[model samples]
Target: MFKKPTTVNRMSQPEDFKNAFVVGTANVQSDGKLKWKIVAIFPNAGSLRQHGNILVVAGPGGGKGRIITVNLISWGHSAIVIDLKGETYTKTANARYKVDNGKGKVVVLDSKNGTGHRYNPLSVVSRDQWFDLAAELISVTNGDPFWSSVANDLWLAAWSAAQHARRPHMPYAVELMKLDLSDAICYFMYYHKDDPATMQHLLDFLGTRPNEEQMAKIKGGNASRLLESMWKTVKTTMTIFNDTILLNLMSGHDVDVEGMFYNGGITTIYVIVDETKPRVFAAFGRLIMKTLGDALIREGDKQNVVRRPILMLFDEFGRVRLNDVFDWLDTLRSRDIVLCIFLQKLSQFAPKNGKEFDESDENSFHHWILFAPNNPSGRIGKLISGMSGQTTVRADGGVGRSVNMDGDITTSRNVSFARRAVVEQEDYETWGADQAYVTLRQLRTEKYVVTSANTDNLGWALPPEAQPLPRLSSYVSPLMPLPSEIDAATWTAAQQIVEEAGGDDAVSNAMRAALGGLGMAVTV
Candidate 1:
């Protein structure tokens, strides 16, 4: 049953609903309208975002170093720096344990002073991966030419040897190259004709012990002379030896695998091979990166992976001629191997006039860190902009209006409106010489717009005097002993050979003596 409401009068004065809702500075009146003074409006600051990889791009002395240092201090992640320029991060700063969270160890491979080193790639990577690197080097040099086939066949043969010798995990393919395929291995000391027979003979000598006839053939040819001049030539050309040491450094040691990991707790790794000769450094860089990718893949296959995801930062990447690096990056992301590649200008990547650049699997890098583009409207600039999802708008005249005059007899009024409309948005155009971006994804990616308040900022680029130089330094230290010093030590130890060989048969005695000095014992 519904009960009729009875009004009960109380001293509470009907408890004013407006007063009940009112605060110190705002009120709801009897009309049921709320009023308040407007103070300020603020937007949300957005999410605190983090990326697995961060690529810093700026011209020399543009504050990249400062930014990188700040980020390293803020986030405690491991970094493996390939200190190309010995000057970027000085030893004083690097000596401190907490600078890069103790993960910032510098590998200085300086070719100038002849103190470079090497490592065993097989110790860290699989056989197949090493071969891939070698194959890439060959492909870059040969492209679609017939020499690429030869390089492939040579690589396969070397790979087979590594597998047969139970060195599937060793860098036997690279080591096989050390045995001197031609007298040219000694550089300017001698030149062997670029013939298949000569190449095959060199391979046979390295892979197996040659018989009497084969040795006689080699002895009668330039091989014998090369064998004699090898030590002298190695002494004169310290740069070549330095390059070899760099290769050995990437070859991981058998015992201390952890040491090779460069496990400093920093996210960024600047492999500063900046001081190395451009061609040699590029070759080594390609080899090390390829080996790293292969090693990570192999480790991923294992039950327990010890290392974290790595960022291989290739600064001045175009100089290295590691075009095949794109392919490795394309596939390695799933295994957590990210590549942070830097190039001076995109146009430098195009093949020169009358030369064809390899376009196989172009568009390999997932992210680009571009700074101070030389030609914003150039082909490479447009291409990069398109890949990075940047857009440009153009406006043109759209509509007009006219009006008739109302009062004046001799004057007529006309009204016209200037209308603005979007005319066109340019898309990247493809060219035969230009590399294509085949890998495009539809994902909301994040990119930070980095700008400096100071115009006089000094960063990674070279100083004013060195701007016109063709190549930038990418020097880093090696993992092994300096080959030049080692070779010198070996030669100093060989003085004993000349003394021992001064007998009835000086040639035979010299052969035996030289072999013994080289730490090899010959059986009668």
Candidate 2:
């Protein structure tokens, strides 16, 4: 209903923020005082920094989206950005933040070209987190009910076994996926013998004998069908792990979430997904969001407070539905974890998930910058309008008529007033190419014309001059210890046997074969 503010106002950098980090100009009054309209993240004032989480709904080519990215980087906030196009953050934001006087660094993990740091989703967290990780993986289902439950149970069993094994590094995806049902059952039977209750649960689930009879029954009876069904459901979930490049990134503990956000260090994790492999990248994206969110919460609890506020700037955030996204948004602020989700449409978040965004999800965000929707009546616009409330406006004007009688003319007038929403549904139908609507926790909603930051103030351009992430180039290399390396005590006998062998090839094969005997046919 009203035009966006136009009088430009300049603001000085805050002490906490990096030097020369200008978000945008505000308006100054004739009395030599300045008035701001929610421009900079942590403005010269102190209160703005308290509420860090923000949500941006923008479409392609809207400069506002880039503005948000630039300001966050300029402020030197530690962030993990999931950029689909490999442009903004890697080229601009990364360079800008690196030059900052703060203790922040940018590391890009390109999944397509294998150029950045190595981050093994499975290996990144501790043993205590494996259960949650498995739950995240299974949460992305394909709408099949029976198979989904079977796969969930199978993944739980395999994940539990991996944690119990307590190897030097986390077990590989192939190791977990190739685990035979019979073997998982036996491993649990022997390892959990002291815990009769757990053993009983496994025995009841597998529906087979405890010892030698188990493998035979698993290979032939109704248990065989169940195992096959479970594997069928899990095979698709294993696609990302089966990939050589993806496995390498996920095989080592290269990117540590807690350490990155621990001491005000700005660690940038760029998850580059290949367009050719949508499903693979999709799964990895979901895994990263879920795992990182969980880690931040745990780390915060351990330290009682987060040293630096961590921001997760996910572009096309709708690409993956984070299993516990709602829970995270509701509680992560206690740990100083801020979420800035960028999406083209609101429906994308719950697309095909049969899940609806609840009031809790809506209330969790501190701010929302809703760009002009592609269509006025589109679902996103309606949803946003519903939250922002309706507006009433005059729809018609007054009419006047004159009548003549005996000697004089009598004048009469009739006035009419109609009401309509301040922001008409039609406004969204034909959204101006460059218009956007911003909402704050306090103000609720206000319109703004998108603007870009001063390019001169920003740092370097495309191809930032940053060092490669420090991680072993390849886990499959023969010179390196096998991915399954465990404690020195457990490997003592095996280490001696391998030392006696003339070459590593035979020992590696023997070790792999030994794992196969235990029912995890890991293809090293």
Instruction: Provide the overall lDDT of each model, using Cα atoms, as 2-decimal numbers.
Output: 0.35, 0.47
- lDDT for model 1: 0.35
For all predicted structures, in order, the TM-scores are 0.44, 0.61
lDDT of 2 by residue, 131-245 (tens): 5566666644545444445454555554444444543222333554555543433344344334433333333333311233333444354432444544555666665566667
lDDT at 325, model 1: 54
Per-residue lDDT, model 1, residue 175, is 49
lDDT, candidate 1, 117-164, per-residue tens: 334555565444544554556532213333343344445554454444
Candidate 1 segments exceeding 4 Å error: 1-69, 72-75, 91-96, 99-118, 137-270, 274-276, 303-307, 348-363, 372-376, 384-524
Consecutive 10-residue window with the lowest summed lDDT within model 2: 392-401
Estimate the overall C-alpha local distance difference test score of candidate 2. Answer: 0.47
Question: After superposing candidate 2, which stretches have Cα over 4 Å from the reference?
Answer: 1-22, 25-52, 93-103, 123-128, 139-150, 160-171, 179-233, 303-306, 351-361, 373-375, 380-465, 468-472, 475-524
lDDT (Cα, 0-100) at 482 in candidate 1: 14
> What root-mean-square deviation over C-alphas does model 2 reach?
13.7
Q: Tell me, what's the RMSD of every candidate?
A: 20.6, 13.7
**Backbone Cα, N, C clashes tallied per candidate:** 49, 5
